[model samples]
Target: MSKKRTGVFVCHCGTNIAATVDVAKVAKEMAGEDTVAFTKEYVYMCSEPGQESVVQAIKDNKLDSVVVTCCSPNLHEKTFRDNATRAGINNFTCEIANIREQCSWVHNDKAKGTEKAIKISRSVVRRVNRNQPLDAIAVNVTRRAMVIGGGVAGIQAALDIANAGVEVVLVEKQATIGGRMLQLSETFPTLDCSQCVLSPKMVEVKRHPKIKLMTYSEVQELTGSVGNFQVKALKKPTFVDPDKCKLCDECTAVCPVVVPNEYELNLTARRAIYIPYAQAIPASFTLDESVCLGLNPIVCGKCKDVCEADAINYDMRPETVTEDVGAIVVATGFDLYGQENMGELGGGKIEDVLDGLQFERLCSASGATKGHILRPSDHTEPKNVVFIQCVGSRDPAKHCAYCSKICCMYTAKHAQLYKHHVPDGRAYVFYIDIRSGGKGYEEFVQRTMEDNDTLYLRGRVSRLYRHNGKVRVLGTDTLSGQNVEIDADMVVLALAMVPSKGTTEIAKVLKIGRDKDGFLAEAHPKLKPVESVTAGIYLAGAAQAPKDIPETVAQAGAAAAKVIALLSQATLSRPPLIARVRRSHCTGCGMCVDACPFIAIRLENGKAVVNEALCEGCGSCSATCLRAAIDVKNVTQLQIYEMIEACLAV
Candidate 1:
């Protein structure tokens, strides 16, 4: 019940705060507060000497609590708290008042800004007065990691984690692990064969002892918290046993059902029993259950009969497998914007017109026309090709407002590849502006324009439609102040990259957030790009935003390193600032459980119980509790009330 000793430190932040708010006046006013035994103003409180002064004052004045009035706590809260710990005071006793972002930055009036800064500092001082010493909560770790998605990002993350001696569970929704990256003929900049670079990594994932690759599978449910998570993954049956199947083509030859091959982007037909590609991991065949004739022996038995290895199993059913892991990495990748939505362009209706991926297929050796750049409608080589960029990007009125970062570079790569295939072919590109912003990317685009003689027009295409045997492109050349028209044999649309359908579904299952554009949201865009809002969860590749291959791989490796660091810990230290339930306040209506987003609250023995490890200290449970029995540890209702009173005090 004795009076507490508090110290207040105001920072000038090199005119960031001093320019608008009078730091010296704020410090002088805080010194008059009853509990404030020490007060100081520093030019830069976050600098080494500034921090040393704070620690020295705490020691000399015997301060029990401290408040630092400066920039956002997000940037320097830990620095000041560590200083408190260094000076033998409890770290929880230190608090932050964001005078820069909340006060100075927004206001130009010096007098009003100083007045507001004083109020902010006084409010934090009141909050820190009631702050109690608390220790970090320690939770046991599972020492394993799960990576969702089987693209280059997922594969790289899994491989990196596995290489570090941590067990990995890799789940893929498709029949194979290659994802969209495998479907491309060549990558941008260097123009290396996509398969040749990625296939080796896929094979490494298949052979790695520490990695358990689960293809034709999906994560159905995720439960538990950071250091301990239970994942229920539904492994759909492929109907062809991987171990028993031979690499022979006899079964696919006899299958009667023919469907559009997804790997070929429907540019080719495939049988009911087929392998994704010759270099598919596991080297097995898959029976497309959706399009196949009834799996009954009386209905369709040709594939079973033709399989000399007897690998076909008609009675196979979906099985759910459970995995326990400490951390999870989401690398769900991306999908192109649906072509059906582009009615203004000849998309999904015109055979010769294709999206970027389909064009890559046309250039692929294993594609429908055997690497020939022939028009799909007439099966003849296209003498003229038109490439359009920003088809569904940077058009705030109708499409995505943000730029699809890879489109500009890839569009240039597409033009260069087209010219390479057909030496005499004329290539035209219609774009708003070029955004080739990577190492060697700008040079590559220049080479394509100068060496390949590809014409770059600064304009937006108005409309595209089939005219006679050729497709007519209607657009304007803004640089030339002229309207332009082209009768092209083939037109390629560089559709915007969007979060895949699976990425959306998985976000809900993982209880993570998605941005307005539907990409997974990072915890902090600059400092914590790979970390998701949820603890123990990380993001990589286009699932976060549209990015190129090199960036994707780099992010994947970074995510893997984070996982390795998390799992390597013997016990994880969670923030002690989680919710706590007051058992004496009785009624357990279970409302807190429903209101909790992280699934951190539960009713036990007809009373609310909070799992400290799972709680994010968001105060949702406390707000939903009508009895006021639940509260976050450090940010209690009493502290909030006292802080509000101090802010209102004239």
Candidate 2:
């Protein structure tokens, strides 16, 4: 509402900014401009006395606002803000010119860099002159979280949060909570049954008073921000409602329609109205919408007629349930690459070919053919089995340049499993680099070779094709420099790991940015790996990158810690630099609203109001202001403009 008696402090940053730019020349140059009280350049403006210098200058010059031309605001905007605020000026009155990263870090020519830095300073001064005093906003955190996946990571997150005495909603896309872990008979190296370790946790999740498990459900839409997120979950009609269905098989026995069971990776058949598996959580049966006579084509309601509990609802339609949560952990695990992604690997075309997950399901006792590995084409067993490694992953030529870290271990596990079950089965593995870098990982792979009698070939499988009923794998052994071919009863492809197809969807929903590969981008690669670049949001599991079980679990725990720490605060503090609306001058064209991926801006009392919690203060919204009506606090155009005018003092 008032003009700030602004002081501008330009940082030389020890040649990081000074070497290319004539810092003093530009500082003097900008001091000659109007609205510029004084301008000076210091060797290290972010240092202790350097920061105090700005505060001293603010006090000495009787300045209400200060501009510091230094590194990206991401680094030290807050430092200047804090210094200015402590010096009896509003923190938002301190504007930062990003000369270091945007100018000096990229540009080599000194004169050009100095000129560019001055221009940037001028822009920030111009923008900040229109700044206003804004208060931070906070909503009551519900002390609740919604975790979308029920896998080990999700389960761990739910258990931790529930144990912390917070309400948790654990939603599973499947009928059970164990996820891919349950598909495995035993974990590598430890040789412990996956279900034995996971079932107790699953049961604990079911019994936890603070935890609500929503199985066979999907989150349809997510609205709001951290501490105030509203989610709508579409409870796909299971036909057999949990409150009424007793999980009895009487209805399944009478159902006429049967299809290849997805639970068994399509190696077995399930009735049209079948429970996902014997130990399906909530233990409720689901009628297949595609095949149920009544629901499928509106032809078969046979399972309903014979039902004693009257659980069948033939007209059951998708229902939406909305809940408020303080935070969201996107544990929506991952799906293995299907036939569509593995065209070069002879994926669905071969009856015996399977992805790593399908192979796990195929070998389980609950799987099709009852744990006897056989070709789907003929159900016959053979002596030779070949495992193709890096099928869809780790191929730079295919855009999967980075290794999917889990493939090597899991492929090795599959080979050992085949060897264990087939007794006389010969298991051979082809690979490029064996990345068993996790704890107990190298030994696990070694044990598979030594103890399990599995052979490992260091190379790639160039091609795979079906001959007669069996598939043949052809590749070269890089170690021996020999062309190798194997005809096998079954061939398992360790498909490449890519970010989930929903990665982009989650990014949009969160209003966070993602890289070209679609995995979540961290705040910094080395400094802040678990945290997203967007404040108040954290990342976990394969959603962040390709990781094995251990790494994924560890990241999940890290994400939980971040959430707990954030919620633990009495109230969160945001950066003083945020986009502010000039209400009288505002047109409310909604350009800023549309441009904001975070949904930070909304109409309040018919005028624009920015939810400080949602705003990232990226200045994208300010740039979109048609009338230049929107200016970011502290870093307004006038402040930047004057700072530039002062920097280029002629």
Q: How close is each model in CA RMSD to the real structure? A: 2.6, 4.1
Instruction: Compute the lDDT for candidate 2.
Output: 0.77
lDDT by residue (276-381, candidate 2, tens digit) is: 7676777788877777655743566678778899998877888889988777776655666566666656748777787787787767776666777776777777
Highest lDDT model number: 1
Name model 2 segments beyond 4 Å from true: 1-63, 104-111, 296-298, 573-650
What's the residue-level lDDT of 585 in candidate 2? 74
Stretches of model 1 off by over 4 angstroms after superposition = 18-22, 100-116, 587-621, 648-650
Backbone clash pairs in model 2 (N, Cα, C under 3 Å; residues 3+ apart or in different chains), count = 40
Question: Candidate 1 local accuracy as lDDT?
Answer: 0.93
- Count of steric clashes across candidates, in order: 0, 40
